[model samples]
Target: MQSDLTNMQPPCGQIQRRTFLSDLGYGATGMALSMLLNREGSGQAASTSSGAATQGPHFTPRAKSVIWIFLSGGYSQMETFDPKPELNKYGGKTYADTVYPDPFQDPRYQERARSVVQVKREHDKIMPMQVGFRKQGESGIEITDWWPHLATCVDDISFVRSMYTTDNDHAAEFQIHHGRHKLDQKQPVIGSWLSYGLGSLNQNLPEYVFLGSYTDTRVKENFSPDYLGPKYMGVEFSLDPNNPLPFGARPQTVLEKEQANQYALINELNRISSVEYPHDEKLRARINSYELAFRMQRSVPEALNLDTETKETQRLYGIDENETSSYGKRLLAARRLAERGVRFTQVYLSGYGEWDSHQKLKENHTRSCKRVDKPVAGLLKDLKRRGMLDDTVVVFCTEFGRTPAVETRGSTKMPSGRDHHPHGFTIWFAGAGVKRGYVHGATDELGFHAVESPHYVTDIHATLYHLLGLDPTRLDIPGRKRLEIDRGKPILDILS
Candidate 1:
């Protein structure tokens, strides 16, 4: 019976179903190919690789890499590094009569202006900074009451208090990341520029890496390589302390031999396609991406592994504690990447209400400060101890700043929080050629605006590139002209 069944033939019209199915599959694949061809011909399928080999900065640089620490929400200059006594004297009064001119009162901020007053009415009278200020180190720069840990390292940092931005809202977030006004033409981020200019120091590792708690909110689709193409865009890593970069671990079932076989088959197909379309940059980029993906499969995992680090070293970064562990691990990872020649690393501080202080100004800022204080100070100390500080530049910045006026909305008796202030803020720089134990700029009597020698975000970018041995003005790509936004003058006054 089994033999008879095996030899049985189907009816005339049902002549081998397998053959029919294979023909249908081939027809569908051909149709898909035709559609792809049509799309390419219509320019709907764009290639993002044509701008890969642009010449970078023109001059010899001093620093090889940078580690950026971005404080997401506006950190209050008055509460943090910039101490002002006038805010205390005129605490509860409206600045409606002052020369400060309600800079944020434009029609764009009408809603925010209304909300600010409401918040102020409910919260406690313009609260004085809970923490005291002290002159630290030989420089005698006044640092806020909350940052004793950071104060100890003042000799290793340059504090710029007169930094200002054009945007008043969270949109400044985009401006700082992309180095252009939020309203202007979007440009490649500072990191992407560096990746394009320097290429990768470690082929196994990405040239640009972003790690932090607010990774999702911070990543912009426009946070891309833009005209420089996909090759220069940063490789974003998850903020997880254990595993950061996506797909950084080894595959369990896919053995080396199987991967190699698959790669060879893909390569053969790509080669044949390349012959048919020799001028296709997209095809070339795809081939390069496959090769990079394979290399990353090996290099990323090795770079992320923290088991080799000494237990004491881990503890020094506050990895042993819960509150500080996550950010601490990120900082340590950044340091490790810096040591391994990663050109750009950004570590974001996580958690809700991180420097926002909408309601509980004292409790909120204090708690947030404690969480990062040790890890940041430790990162600086560790870098200096290892002699990496001389070559690596560490930047600490916030989006904007909190207002000097008290916010009283939501409650009338609670400790008032500050609103967003874009006129003036503070940022600190350490390592590379930055002058240590120095303060470069200042705000006025009320600490409301940058009244003395104000600097913009572009100045920071220029200074950073200068430290990294690149002239910010000279980086250029072929064919595409450099825009005015790309030509930034370096702030030489603060350079060591």
Candidate 2:
């Protein structure tokens, strides 16, 4: 009976029917493919009832792709970009000891801080900047010596030194991408929204791709589509070119020709199922996803093939150096994917909370900076030289910044490190629509608050959407009414 079913072909006028067992085995791939595709709407478009164009870019798009580089733990704003010479001057002094107004006394301190857990403020004494800073690039932006490579590219970057978020812990990692505190309901991340609102520039690859390590399961929320459905979730890729995708490669036992034949049969079956249940959105999505999954099996590996790149190009990403090789590969792959039309590529330069320098601020930050600085700078230079930077927005950000005050609880009684400071931080952007070599907004002299042109995490989302020609307000579904905060106003000051 199995042999008969496998060999049988339906007459031209009649429908082909297979036994349930035959369908079950061969249909598994298609079913899995549907889940992989995560196609929730029609081909290349969203099915929102907002009466807005679902295939987005509601206005003229300045960027074609986004390279969102996230450092999992907080990097100090004062030490990195904000450069608080005051911290060094006021070292060992309490907030009241400083001649300047006490930061903790500021009315906005309690207003901005929404701590998930009660934080013990034992670190009362202010800590000076652990690293030295030098003016860099034509912009003369005062960057710490740790990021000597990235400092060279400062003239092309726009620094927003006053970015802040409500979440005061590691949860801010999720908030940076989704624009909501972890206490609040999970909303669709920026990458997911972009996936929902826009069509694929490369049909073979996912609209949103995640590269690098995410061993911390909680970080998964950063790429989730949530209400947008599973298909819109960021598809993670392995740096290993031989095995780039998860469950994406064909089984060795199944010859290429045989698998192709099976997919064809599945397609026919899906086509028949579609006609029988024309309104089954899930079925339609599955059909689309299966097709894409098949294409991805071939295309994704090629996109990750760094060996094909010249020795110079490899060195350009710092791939030759042991210190920078791992992160270099990811950034280099991101550039490859972006140039090939991947809409959004989220690269984790380090693992979860790796930058959370609760202790050893100098040691931790120096090692962290070394791992990413060269690769990041290389990405910018390569993008510019290849003309990809003209339409690719590169965002360099951390979850938040370390506190200006010293942390005295763990082991060290002396002020050796800073605690988590959600009050204010710095994030930067380069390429695409943003003005080059400009600094917008700032922290107070003490680096304890976002004292100028402060922006919530969502403002970054709004800026990205605007640059990509998406109207965040218009990307709504029928039932999901987003809050005003969720649809944050774009930072117009930074836009070119």
Candidate 3:
């Protein structure tokens, strides 16, 4: 003031000394801050960002999506689709004296061994399927009495009774999802691989979706995207039967317009920041996710709204009944997801009480079957009727098959349960290019092993990819090399 800086305004051509210093300081500070923030954001982006997207298989795929129905805890082959007459004759006997040594000798195997409820020694006493088997459709493929509705669609299914695996315990369950046994070395799950191979067709919806009830808390190593990272992992919305996904709808207080404004503002800020830091892929992904989330809020609600479905369709899916309602809803939802171009949809059979019928085999298996059979049949029929069957592949599989012999360890003399048998099992395929109404491969007389045309879980995975027009052998990650087991061949005979 005394120097006339305020009054004179530093003359016409000259700037005030303090003013110049202040402007310079501000510019330096702004530049430094910008640089610091950019560095920090860049570092974060490098750590969190994913690699470039890859292309899918070469040929035009028959199936645009896959709906895998995972019957957890080993579904018994004898009791379900593959009825063994031998079990009926040799029920309640011992095969311990046979040449085959017990595979469950390690300390890690203690859980299954202790949990087993054996009715006889050696667990090879063939337990006849409590449910009757009848040939269905023109193909006359055999199915259980419990699954009358599913039987109607047998002509559209291709049964594989010769599937085999290495792991005999629950640990082996990993193979069902990842196509490998050793748990230490994590591999990309089938869904993850698919997601990685084929980016989402609908940007609003995730490529892979897991629909089920989370009543069973026993965490298995299977249901995750092992080495593929979080990007490829499937998103789980709701695991409750009453409400399958969480965070679907917003509160009434949060109006749609307000939500839109909030998202817009966030996205604008992200975009502005992204320009200052072009290498920030994480920021870009975050912006993309926000838009996707908003779209999902609208899309998912519409997809889940069963009110739009006719009453007859609702009844078909068993939405009216309590027992079948939960799974039925899931199956219906799966069909909807497939129709919407979601790539992979995995539906878990809900309710606790394992299919691992170590105590009451007949009672448990029958109840489980009742809960699943109708809804499953309804799903297949609905798909076929909607004309989605030709382009959608539906796979029905379990962790493994039960022991051919009765497990009589911790119970009364009369064997009541089956032990874990990963040696051989049955899985069914339908839709897409799969040959309809055909049975491929066979198990031994006692259903102990795959004596003819033994196929591994990887083969099934490869065949699925092949049907989807993906070459499983060619799917590669830049850093992590694949193993031979991962390079499985397509099950050609089953493919039409």
For model 2, residues 1-496, the per-residue Cα lDDT tens digits are 2364335677777654434423543455533433375543343224445422457688999998999999988998988888999988988888888888877778888877787887765357888888899998888888999898888899999999998888777888999999888788878899988877776898888889888887678877888888777768888888976678776677777676776776787678777766655665555665566667778778988899999999998998899999999999999999999989999999988989888888888889889989888999999999999998799999999889988887776566654677888889999999999999999999998888898999998999999999999988788776677898987888899899
Mark the 10 consecutive residues where model 1 has the least summed lDDT. Answer: 35-44
Q: Lowest-scoring 10 consecutive residues by lDDT in candidate 3?
A: 36-45
Among all candidates shown, the one with the greatest TM-score: 2
State which candidate, 1 or 2, has the greater lDDT. Answer: 2
Q: Candidate 1 or 3, higher TM-score? A: 3
Quote each prediction's TM-score. 0.81, 0.92, 0.82
Sort by TM-score, best first: what order?
2, 3, 1
lDDT of 1: 0.69
Tell me model 2's lDDT, rounded to 2 decimals. Answer: 0.83
lDDT of 3 by residue, 28-142 (tens): 2222222112212222113423333345655788788999888878888877878887666666544454334333342322322322232233454556657789889999888
Which of the two, 2 or 3, has more lDDT?
Answer: 2
The digit string of per-residue lDDT tens for model 1 on 67-184 reads 9887777888988899987666666666664545554443423422222122322222344665788898888888887887888899898889988776666667667767666566
